[model samples]
Target: MNQERSTLPSIWSAAPPGGIDRSAFTGKKPNKIIPVPHEYRRQTLSRERDMLIHDVEQKTGCDLVPHWDQGKVTSFDIYGSGHGVEKATVYLNHWISNAHTKSIGASAWAKLPAYDPNKWYYAQVEELDNVYKQRFRGPVPSEGDADAPRHAAVVDWPEDIKNTSQEFVSPREVFGNKLERLDELRMQDKVYITLQQSNHDGHWYLEILGHDVVDVELAREHLTTMIQTVRADAAGVQDAHNTILDEREGMEVELQQCEPWWPNQADYVVPQLLSHAMMDKPGSFRQEGLHFKQHLSLQRSIKAALDDVRRRKGAYDFVVRLGCLALSSKTVSKGIIGRTVSKDSFSKQIHESVQLDVKKWLANNEIGCRILHRLMAVKGFLEPTKSGGYFGYTPETLKETRPIFRGTWVFKDPNSSVVATQTSYRHPGRPAPFQKPVEDAQAAPMSLFVIQIDWTDDEQGMYEKGTPTFYKLPPGATGPKKNMDISLLELGESRAWHFALESLIPVPRKTVSPVLVGFAERVRMKRNYDISSTESFAEWDTTLNIKKYLQTGRLDSIYSFGIEKTCYKVELTAMWYPSQQLPVWGLAVRHLEWASHLAELEDLPIGRQAMWLDTISSFLPDDGQSSSNIDEDSDDCGTRRLKVDDSDDESPRDGIRILTDKLMKLSEIVSSVTDCGGVQI
Candidate 1:
């Protein structure tokens, strides 16, 4: 009952001086959280897992071990589209379809096919060995021999490999299904409530969007059937999207930081090397990450699906209030969040660079003609009967679509420094280079200016509606003031990271690399800043707590601390190459923002004050951690009690940072989860 039912006024505005009117209550009504039982939740996840797997296999024609390739091949590698590389080979002694028979000369041999577009046709290479070598010594048969003793005609496909897990269920297709359900949820309701979404759909379903739910139980008996059906019933799908966020820099969620210190050193040597290190790490996240904004927008849009009921809660603000404000007191354990790995981020970046080109090369290039034909076989378009390969859409459903927004970008040189040196473009008197036009000598030679928004993301993503303008051109695009003068190191290219860091990176960036920003710098905020930022001390304290929770996977990990006892280093390397930087800074900010929001709700009146109880009577730590307390009659249509945990360990997690050089501060600081066990991959 203490949960605030009244709507929080919209914080964004399209007009000047006075941004969106904050005084008027204009957002959607909040949802009521009705807690369900654990068994019910588990069963529902189980059932959905089974059904979805069957559905995907049926639609794709991958039902049996024989339907695919007559069992000739066991496992094959799939490259591109996030699939890494693997090797392959073909057995020539297999069944021949021709009727003629001819003997092969001693020099005759079989040639293996080369790489195909977007697909790895085989798994290994026997590379036709020296003609008579024992391993290559098979009864030599003619190409036209229809009855050559074939390699085992009934070869079995290994269902155990990662690529073949689709025989169990398709991850790509499941992601498609999750998106579809999200689309449905977005349309049905006018005003979406994080509390309601979490309770009804389960945190696994909402974790990608960053919502950590706290349940208020209604009744025990009603929960019996509710648990088995509610979660699966409302979500329409399970959130099994394990596609790793390809933006790892300093995103390991580790409890350490690394960088050279001392301000005197910032100006002297080649700063680009330091920037290169940052680039090798995670760069600005929220803005440029793959689909960061899409997940966020999906959550926000869930309220009305962009229909009649309007919501002014940009992704960041709502999470701050929801995680930081609404669910401040509790931890969400049933939640299914994502995993963030440095390798995934690094690989993603690497693949994206050439994945497209590789696909084209394998398709249009003359060398690619045969390779392209091989792809259609497994793709279900296997018609050696036709000339132009045509593997049409499987189980053709409605084409998936989401909202889009107009946006701009500036940074291009991955070598630019995140640290402010005497010669840096952002150093005091120097004009902000990112703010300049591409033609300006000060600007990045390959600077990007326009792009679209992925409205379904949730990594603190933001987007503007009007035609985007450039470098500090005043009378802001949607409001009276310009969007810059933000004190953090330039996102250089990622507005997504800036918005995400509006709540996450600084403390952690400073935590590892101390010399980046000054102590005094962290303390100041301009009166008219577009993004609502917290003081360094608040951010610092919150970040430290977040670090502990991530490592321990415990809700009790969050405890208040004194700013004086803490040490901070302003990480100025946010401008480092995004790949290297994302795992470090990007992930730190992401975790911090997510946990801080939930911790926000734990404390009332102010974030600084927090109360922790030793044990929760009602929850009872069923899985391993401590649980919540509940009273009798608590289930009398009153509210059920629920706590959301961090996302299950297998989910994908990524990060980004936008720290700038600044001096400052007294501060304190420090940060997988499983979704459902036996969850079909």
Candidate 2:
């Protein structure tokens, strides 16, 4: 009842923001009984999928199978003014002809006479090797002998192979008839609550959008029957229409007749008129009469569809709400009521309703649906197509989009005792120079910046919340704010370790190993500063959950925290190069490897290989230990056990420190590699 008042005739012209307004044309008494034209225009064309298929088989020597229902295809009509009928018929006919030609070969297509631009034609073919076979229109090589088997006779097209011309031709066309008939039946049984329009012609047409649910299981039957009635009733006609203005008086008189004692009388009558008008208009829908009629229609349909499971305390309602908000103009954020619903509730509804159903809406609107699917993936809501580039948010990652921000690190060259250094990490790859190093390499005094966003997608997926900007400040400084006195390390040239920390080389320089003592001096000059950042903790949590869910499809798996504990384990990773200096190369490599390898694994598949490697690598001899291996029980106690290699006077005690230094270097390499998201490529 409240819904009826909201959609009263007076509000028919109301339009939402960013949409066309037509409310001005509503509510006032009609000057005459003439029907009001539907807002959208409709053009009709001869509809016959089966006839087309038949023609195709006769002309082309091959067979084709239709994936759509023939009856539904025939539901389309050829109607319009100013060549609308001719234009529509020709258009559909040519498409059919083209399908036939393409299915056969260029040779067969060329043999068919040029199609008349103003007439309709039909063709059909059978499925051969699961591909629709049609006539070829291009040249075919002639056989040397007159009796040689004809080249144009028949050919096979494999289902798995790629064929550009036939890519748009789906096997589903065979079901078009059945679906169309179902739609017709649905429309007939439905008591429409709003305006519906035929194609672009302003004529009345009927289609079953949905049905009322007096009973759940029976509703589907009722809906299907309504759809069939609408289609069958209009099958033979090319010119037809329904207008809202035509029924206004009858509704008003009916309301007046039941006046004084009736409760919610307007509700019953208004819905009846709206339904009548909807039936009158075939290919049209109410965009103005009701602010969100289509949304309401689908919502109601969903309610009915889930009737069997509706009684269960499921996440359906939450998903519906979240999807509606996401697709709306609402801004999403923490504390925002609709922003952070659990992924289970948020992702499911969008995946099923918005992603799947809305696709059909576009098709009915004469728009394609493929691009929309891609857009969903871009926003991180739905699983991306196989060819898409974005990773992180897949099921393997707890089905969460990882949020990352741009960040930079500065540190002095360990070889340069005089200066501290800083570094930056970026997307295309890690900050260069550090990724590749030689023996005499010097730490590049540069900044590293990385940007990342979470994988959760909003409704319609228009915005992506990537990483935020991060800054590191010097000690005594509150943050990366103005007036903070800080000295930045001066990078002489760039240098980084190659492979693991096996070697170091200077950026842009071929040889000459830089001194470690100088690099150590650079480190001394630097001091820790304040670090400020906005991390995507939600996304992190989501990714962790997604990883678990991927391992186990159960929704309950999301709350499990197995991965979080292991994420921060203190373990050694193999360095890309042998350089004892902590270079980003080793870290970057390790991260890339992890992303590539783990991205494919579910939480359960996360093997122990990495764990084992970390353990074994931690046991390698420290640098100073190798120099004093002859002694086992002496370390100057533990004080001289430092790992730095000194002169002969240095005792085996120093070996501990040496070993510690080597181990630290190794650990740093492993940590760095795994820390990076993955190689951009």
- Clash counts for all predictions: 112, 161
lDDT of 2 by residue, 1-681 (tens): 999887764534432213112233222221111110121112222223344433433444322222222112211222122223333333443443233233322322223467765442223222341131111111222356342222111111123322234342211231242233222222233222112343575442222222234322243344333333233323321211111222221211111111122211221110111123423331122112212332233223322222212111111111100000012112222233223233234334333332111000101100112222222233222222111123222333322322121212222211111121112233565344221111343333332211112222333322233332212223233212211011100000001111111101112111101111112122211122111111111212223212322111000001111112111111111111111221111111111122232222112111111121211112222322122233356555423334222223312222223322232332222222222411110
Give the Cα lDDT of each candidate: 0.20, 0.22
Candidate 1 global CA lDDT score: 0.20
In candidate 1, stretches whose alpha carbon ends up further than 4 angstroms from where it belongs are 1-515, 519-639, 643-681
Query: Pick by lDDT: which candidate is best?
Result: 2
Tell me the tens digit of each residue's lDDT in model 1 across 1-681.
Answer: 334533433333111122122123122111110111111121112222233223323333222110012212211111111101100001111111110132222112222357684354232232223211221122324446653323211111122323222343222233353333222222221111121123564322221111111111111112222222322223332221112222333333211111232111212111010123444443333234335454433222221211110111121211100000000012221121232234434235323431100000001112122222222222221111111011111211111111121122221211121211112123467544221111312322231111111111122322222221222111112211111111111111111112121111011111111111111123222233322111111111223322322111000001111111111111101111111211111111111122323333222221011222211111112221113323454453313223222222122111111111001010001000112211010
What TM-score does model 1 achieve against the real structure? 0.15
